[model samples]
Target: MSTSLYDADYEALRALLKILRVNAKLTQVQLASAMRVGQSYVSKIERGESFVDVLLFAKWCEACGISPGVALDGLRDQKRPGRAR
Candidate 1:
């Protein structure tokens, strides 16, 4: 079994988060405030220096007015092109 994310997975995760922020019409600072974290934390996540586990993921989704299920589905559905099913 794999122990890490594929490059496409990471890119997809980053894109999902960015899209969420944009859809919420939030600046990084604004999202940080709502998530009760520092702006750098949000930046780090966006830059893929950090990742959210399930609990934090849920919290982030809540803060962004998204459902955690949708985020999880996005993460799972970002299968790399040409990857065997």
Candidate 2:
């Protein structure tokens, strides 16, 4: 299948989610519970098989005790190819 413009954004978002979760020392189950979502939903997101709604992304940031803008900034950084590590 062909990728869409949002593909990059989605991948970056997923990466940021994984990084934030690891940095916070939270498991998928814990994060899922915090977000009031299924653990599988978190897994799918981490695997880049799902697209997250902006409101849901905000909820995730809140659950992680972070500002949504901070998470968004990380995603933005990842979207830049050479900037990713």
Index of the highest-TM-score prediction: 2
State the lDDT of candidate 1 residue by residue for 42-76, as single tens digits.
88888877866677677778888999899777667
**Model 1 misplaced stretches (Cα beyond 4 Å):** 1-6, 80-85
lDDT (Cα, 0-100) at 48 in candidate 1: 79
- Candidate 1 clashes between residue pairs 3 or more apart in a chain or in different chains: none
Per-model CA lDDT versus the true structure: 0.78, 0.82
Off by over 4 Å in 2: 1-6, 79-84
In candidate 2, position 68 carries an lDDT of: 95
lDDT of 2: 0.82
